[model samples]
Target chain A: MTRIKSDEPTGWFMIFPALAFVGTLILYPAVNSFTLSLHRIYMGLPALGEPFVGIDNYLHLLQDPVARQAFGVTFGFVILSTILEIILGLGIALVIHEHFKGRGWVRAAVLVPWAIPTVVASQMWRFIFNDQYGLANLVLFGDQVSLYVPWLAYPGYAFLAIVFADVWKTASFAGLLILAGLQVIPEDCYDAARIDGANAWQRFWHVTLPLLKPALLTALLFRTIDAFRVFDLVFVMTQGGPGDATQVIQFYGYKTLFTEGQVGYGTSISMAVFATIFILSLFYIRTVGSSLLKRETI
Target chain B: MRYTSKQAWLLGGILLSVMGSLFPFFWFVITSIKSQVRVEAIPPTWFPDWNFSFYQTVFTDHHFLRYIGNSLMVAGSTTVVALILGVPAAYALVRVRMAGKVWILGGLLTVSMFPQIVIVGPVWQMLSTMGGLNTHWGLVLPYVGLTLPLAIWILATFFKELPTELEEAARVDGCTTVQTMLKVMAPLAAPGIFTAAILTFIYAWNEFFLALLLLTDPVKQTLPVGIALFQGEFTMPWGEIAAASVLATLPLVVIVLVFQKGIVSGLSAGAVKS
Candidate 1:
């Protein structure tokens, strides 16, 4: 009763079509982005007529105020959102760790936000925050604070609004990943903690927290990286409005290339994004890559 | 060891967390049904008189139906293409370990991470040149490219985990490679395929940037683009937008609920464990 005789060459041919498809879509786009980032172009009537300008675009971009501010906002959003998500995510995962009825339903319901598209969620929340008819303003501030404050219209609140939406949509993602980590902990460690008279908090702190490190780190890595690339939500919510408050690095990069028709400059902005993500990913890979890899594979 | 005070605290934490999570959704649903004045009223109304006016308006006011149909077509087509292309690729990577496979996989991951803006320029030019702009195929082609790598990796990992004996037996019984894949392996890998389908559907459904860049015609717009067009200065009818968003999300929500297992497995499977 043997199965799948190892006829490897046929298998190779079968996968080649997919390889070519990805190459055109993914690989080429990535490389193309870098190439354009290095070139300078002139925005004309319709088509972009351009000449080459090597690192000039990047050098100018490095000193660009708009680009720098977007970078700052992006860093702030990613760091803040990742921290909140991990904390809240871990808290939720711990609670679900208990034996309870309707737990499955609860878990599924919590994931609803995570599953919804960012655009939909952002729009939903944007409407909710609408100063005139928004639920948030009506409920939280009311007409007393002047419902005309336009939550998305103000810079600070705009950034806050985007973060709020992101946190709502993604915290469950952190929870699920952390929950998977919780499942992997050996039952005996908790049993030992109980026998030692450790309180619930003590047991969690000394036992669960350490055990869940890999999952925590993994969630952090994914969420943080995603935060840096945050575009759709912000794009939909504010389009980096109210004087560039909500604008993140990605949005700025995109505008430079597409909206402004500065291909070279836009590419540089994107290159900066790539470089930013690359550095952050390196630190993550260096720190928890091995541990996360082991846990995931095994 | 036995259950103690810690268990009670744990339960309390769970309750609070659940409340935190479910409140916004509850709020959104309630708000969606409320009148504009009630929705905008101070201290907010927790409950609303049931009204379908917003839904009615959303349906009548914009090209909601067209947008939804576009979404379905694009998502459905992408799912079909991703499955056709990704399944075999995944199998090949798993079974053959073909040369440059690692590079191929790496390339896929990079694209998945590639911001939509970067490629939209060239892709738009390419699609327009091919006369695909604003058509369903333009969106579908990019989606297939976007999702195939992920689908392949996920399916390949699942395929790798299957017992090799079933396929070997089929081969010994004179089943050709395609026959073995179709008859023997496909059935066994149903769960993984479901995961891939659900995932592909989600990406296609939620996709915004490419849809925004490529599909410019309001009548031909996808759901995301259609909703975005509703955003305007002077007035953005909250009730209408909410209604449309709720409607747009209904299919996705239903899909997520019905395919909860597949959703989770798809997300986790696509990510790691290779």
Candidate 2:
């Protein structure tokens, strides 16, 4: 293979447009957000002119009960939704991998949920979970459904409803990634396992599971990070409902920043969320991403 | 031959999963066509009565068409901008021998993963200062930045895979770098371009958080936020909301079904590749 000796200045020039756009739009906001986080800008105050507080915003976040609850809620959400999505996604992937009739249609059907907007999905689910007219209460409770058990209005049920909605919307995404991974596994490996007198379960456990690890890990990393930073689903479904039951960190930060107009405190919350996601991304890249990349090259 | 128990189980599982996946959409469609009285009925109607007034109400009374127009404008402009900026950058990264290219690509990936809430405050402030708030361009500017990383990454992957001999042949034919990229590579990477465009457009269309924060005016709201925030003059209008939701999601659903292969590949490109 011949390596082309490209001019460095030309390369910079080619990349300048994208870099300039991203730098001005993304980098500027990120830097401004960080700077604002260090100040005491209340709602309705211009962020540029806010008084410098020097980490007090971060300290305040630690002491705030709502912020702490949001942390717990966000953690629970990330864990529950990721686990559910992975399990369901794996099952769907495995089933869809089989050479069955109408598999193409099924594959297309699966993408529907993933394709729709999160706000639309959440609203759809909200309608389903409505107390008086929702399908959930009608199907689950039947004739005994006399009293109004507002799903979005209740704390625990509201959280569960959000998780259900998230799992439904995103499991297809996980399935798609895992399905891609499944496609790469050579059929000969499974044939070899079968010739060795291994049962179906044994073949899947030994032959398939190891080969599917990188894909599963990739799917997990994406889903976990996404679930951790979830905003739209929770925002539209219940707006952190009933009394902060479904309030994740993103929703909390949004409320602080937009509704309450506490730009400084809100920016601190945003920073905290970013730091958590950054740490998780680093952890995944170190642990799972390396192996995935190594396997891809091999 | 009669079906085996294992085959039956597999069939059942597949059916169950598909039903689970499509049920919400089915129910949503059902709700859209139900009358207002039936929507709030005690038992909740299982089947629609073929009442199409909600659709009419949503489009006529609610001005949902304007929101759709706004979404198309924003998402379309975002797709165009992301591609124009992203394609060349991706080409440069893939073909050019540059120092710190890896770091640049990694920075793009990291930026892509930023929680939208983190940047909302600053973006809002910036837009407000520039008098861009509540305008289509305000939302489009940020959407372009937000979707560029993914476009660049996907396009870069495609560019890297193209045989270098093609570029060499183009060079031998007296084609400059820009001409070679435009004349030779762009046409060949049409699938990649389609995937990137579809993904970027869907993201911009479906994005709610930024639209909600940036465009507060009812006249300026996009479909997702507009439909979501659609509380009627009095109580919550389930019929109209359902109708609007259907209309809002229909375009994306149709696009996905038509381009399922590209959509799947585009989605799995990042994760499966690296």
Residue B130 accuracy (lDDT) in model 2: 98
TM-score of each: 0.92, 0.96
Name the runs in model 2 displaced over 4 angstroms.
A1-5, A45-49, A293-298, B1-6
Q: Encode model 2's per-residue lDDT on A1-298: one tens digit a residue.
A: 4545567787788899999988888888988899999999877655457788999999999999999999999999999999999999998898788888887788888888998899889888998999888989877777566755788888999999999999999999999889888988999988999899998789889988888988898899889888988998887788887798999999999889888988899999999999999999899888776676676685
- Candidate 2 share of real interface contacts: 0.73
Which of the numbered candidates is closest to the native, going by highest DockQ?
A: 2
Question: What is candidate 1's local distance difference test score?
Answer: 0.78
Cα error, candidate 1, residue A182 (Å): 2.2
Give Cα-based local distance difference scores for all models: 0.78, 0.88
Angstrom error of the Cα, residue B231, model 1: value is: 4.4
i-RMS of candidate 2: 1.5
**Candidate 2 DockQ vs. native:** 0.72
